[model samples]
Target: MTSTRRRGLIDIEIDAQKEKVRKIKEDNRIFDTLETDKTTLDNEKKKWFFTRWFSPTSIDDLEKRIARKEQKIKEGLERTSIDKIHELEERIRILELAKTNRCENVVWMDVPEILDKKIQDDYLEKFRKLPQKIDEQVQSVNITMFGGVGVGKSSFLNTVVTALINNPQRIYRDYKTAPSTTGISKTKAFIPEEIRKKRGQSYREHPTFKDVMHCIVFVIPATTNLYDRDDEALNKIRNLQQRINGPRDVKQVAIVTNIDRIGVPNVDMESVFKYPNVKEFCEDVSKVLEIEIQSVYPIANYHEEQKPTAAKNALALMALWDMFKCGERHIKKKLEIGLNDDQ
Candidate 1:
């Protein structure tokens, strides 16, 4: 009957939607684990069957067991539609917008507050609790970059780091580029299989894969032409994204860089949308990468100087916010927190 009652009802619906999204995320995660395990089991069975065809006393038995496991995984996957997860996400966004009395894409002005230590500490604590090392995948928020070497991945990453720490030089601390003096051989005697990579390292690099990174940044130039090796590298990243977060769910932002060089350098750096060519490039890159166009951003990083500009700083904040939002959704899904949970 009252406004308070209406607000309370909306909050209740929001909580319900959050729970639904969380559950669906867990179901899809289980499905991913099943797929990974089945693949590995299949490979092991094949290796034994092929290598020890005459020596095996139980080759057929192993094959039968793997087939049974694969069937179970397939059934589990079929029971849960991936579309449900997308629906839940949209519903949650709508619900949150209604409750907050805000429009979609409400650019919060509290960047300094968000950069505060308390919020980050709280996030890191919860992120640590997210289930890790699921078969071959790390449960951290991943950002996969797909582009050439000179595409300004380092510069863009530096800008992001500068904004996060409120210090401009943070990006330079660990930033070192490894160059190949002798160019990569396309026609080598043996082109080794491209080794799989993820957010965290194995036992050699890290003791554990928990809360190591709140974000994973993958850099790729926007100039990667279609059907080229750079394009092929982009596909490798696409596959990695699918492998880590499944076909339907991955928090990815394609940082389409070199807008400064693509067209005449706009002295007005914030005028990214002002140029029709820039907008077209953004669309084209997203289409090629098979990601949402909204996830594609045009950025120009500090090449000659380390100082931040108002326009460039705004873009950096935006990119970081996008990445953080991805991390937040991922943390919620992976942790499976309830309304009463401390997170």
Candidate 2:
């Protein structure tokens, strides 16, 4: 099975287990309360008082309730159904198979030749024209990149703008990146200061298609261990996704940066997908972000490179192409749904 599909199945299982645990804990709390009540009734019955003899019926009723709760807990404990057993067997088989076989490439693409200007131009043109072709209310596609402090969100944005403009000499205002000393993000708002200044209005106040972000791109480091990720930061990411994208029904994608750092098959950018580590990283990010595995794009940014290459440009443009498409779809769908609601 493909890493993407396997990751999706694993995510579903994780969510199901969490829900089951929650339900069991809730039931346990109720069971504990019933047990406490039964104990109180038993103690009352043990007292050598007139009330003890009168409350025999209450004690019996409490015992009956406790027995029922105990039975329910027993049933809940035996939750290993046939489907779960089969899923466990399948997971074991996949793991055993992976021990000998290499991971298959999840994403396939033809690397644009360095001399193929026409194809490169087409990519840039398609991305540039998407906003204009979208709904009239959306004059520009606003894409928000958010994630952990120094996961290369700013660098990825710089790479996209650089590739889109196809200019290295042009001094465009860049997003403030993390400093080497303390890896802190200065991007406090969704829209950067430059764009906000140009628009002279805040997206929060406007809440319009033109002002709001249409697509959310979550950036993650290729080396990040999601298991060890900070709980606070992860919660913030989930809340940010829910508050912005979930409510607006905006499309979301994830970018795994620093692909070069993860040992990409002899340091070749073209072999990114062929690298098992890269696919594994993408799968991890997809599961954590609750996005489709296909929506996770892994790429190396032009962090230290002076000029862009065809390979780098192709990766950047591919991600941009998806982002533009996502933004356009969001605009169209939002407008259609709004119209329907009004009618």
Candidate 3:
């Protein structure tokens, strides 16, 4: 009976050990599954963060795309602005009209001779059609002459008219001095002899005597005190203003004659405005001068006998001529406006 009891106890112990081993195996399997799941969740979270925060394209590329879009939008707005279109159209029209009505007042020439064939041809082509041109557009000029008495204002006028008769190349290169007692003369020459004839024989009746005179020339004297307070110079300016038919009918040019006498003491041409009360006087003069005066062109005004072959002198003369031509064009434009108004 003792032997049977001992065998039963050993069997029970063996069963208990088997049960413990099975439980240990199950716990290890559960731990492995949990570890695998945690690893998968961590990998997914990392992928989401990379996609949300980081861009594949560079920063420079992104800025360029934005800028291109802005430019396109600006261009579209500009294209749709009606006011801009109207302004551009108006400017185009004005330019076209100006081109169509351009005047050939001062003709260019290779030689300074009235008889030059080319110059004559140009003159005839323009002059013969003067009436038609004037009707289409009347040109206005303002002329100013500065010089001491005897700088040859009248003589210059004769030369200018002669040049006009044939060609502008015939412009007089020589001028004589006038007496001290007599002041330099300023006049406005107009086209169409009929107008001059009707106005009468006075200097005031010169075609430019009317407020609507077309051309202006300024004759500067050789050694005159242009800034003087005396009545002589002032009177000429006053007379010039009175001749313009209307305020808008004037154009201006400054002719400085007798450059030889320019640098004398108390007679500096450049410092003319520095004289006593000269600024006020000139402003007043401008008010009556009928045109806005821009600058002064120095002329040698040498006599035919006294002329020298100095290259510098010749260059100076050419420069003056060019300057006058530029001013002439400006005056012509103003005249065109007046003519358009009349039409």
Candidate 4:
């Protein structure tokens, strides 16, 4: 067989896999909607005695509808196994890796150069004033990033600090701390299990929002293969996620870094979202980390560039904005819970 023919066959398989994944996602959405409607109907039926007496037939019809929806949901669940999706996705990944530039632009993000400065200034301004607006009990917001070694964790923090400063010449030498003025404090590096365990114990006992992480960011490289990294590292990350976000109610986001390493022709930092593989990579990370796709942000750090470009800065700043919002929401939730308890 000719090489060209084999390549053509692989391309067809990749397309088929992608289509299968899409259909499964659509089916899952329908199942979710059906489940939601069924729950609402069930609640309506359980409401007041007036509802049942005045409209017995209506209630009976609603119950019948709920039963049908439940059956449909059960059928959908049987058909759509999470393991099946993972298998198909793995096949797609293998096929994609076999060919260069196998994926096209599957997603889009508006990144006009004219709007770059506006986005930068808007987020920067918000960060500048956020410290003042935050509740005094919270003191300051902390964002802790957890990932394997060399996943661009420090580089991402550096890029964010540089972009928030909006200065090309201004150098941020320290990777450990983001400036206090930014109203954000980033952990120096990946925390060891012992240190994290100590902190976890302290948090459980004290239960104070102060000096605790409000936002947890998981940095995963786009080029990282699931099988390549150490299993211990990956397991540690998952354990951390369950421990921190599970009990603490801290908002979580996954930052997919090193997107430029992905096979995209003439790819720029701003154009990361334009590549199908980048989006897939984000999806892969999301599935691996159990994070929502929307919460996953893909970015290229300032590695080679001597100075930051607006596109790069804008991308970094966009992720920062998300992290900021997540942190703020965590703080507000704690305050609201405290207020409710007081009442």
Overall lDDT per candidate, in order of appearance: 0.52, 0.62, 0.40, 0.68
Residue 241 Cα positional deviation in candidate 2, in Å, after optimal superposition:
2.6
TM-score of 2: 0.55
Best by lDDT: 4
Ranking by TM-score: 4, 2, 1, 3
TM-score of 4: 0.60
Better of 3 and 4 by TM-score: 4
Off by over 4 Å in 1: 1-147, 165-218, 227-230, 245-248, 264-266, 337-343
lDDT by residue (tens digit), candidate 4, 1-343? 6455332444566788899899897777766677677776666667646455455676677677767757766775544888899998987876566455443435544433222456667767766665465787876668888888888887887777788777776645454565666544546555655563675433443445666678888888777775546676677787787676544677889888777667632223433454677778788877888777878887767765666666667777778788878888888888886732211
Candidate 2 structure quality by residue, lDDT tens digits, 1-343:
6455333222444456556655655665765587687777667677626544565676678778778777776776433454765665565444333332333534434433231345557787765554333556666567777776777776776666566667645422373432322212233324333444565443254454566667888777777767765665566667777665435677888888887666542124543555577777788877888888878888778765656655566677788788768887777787776732211
Error of 4 at 309 (Å): 0.4
Clash count list over all predictions: 6, 0, 25, 0
Candidate 3, 337: how far from true, in Å? 3.5
Worst 10 residues of 4 by lDDT: 264-273
- The candidate, 2 or 4, that scores higher on TM-score is 4
Segments of candidate 3 deviating more than 4 angstroms: 1-149, 154-212, 242-246, 263-294, 304-343
lDDT of 1: 0.52
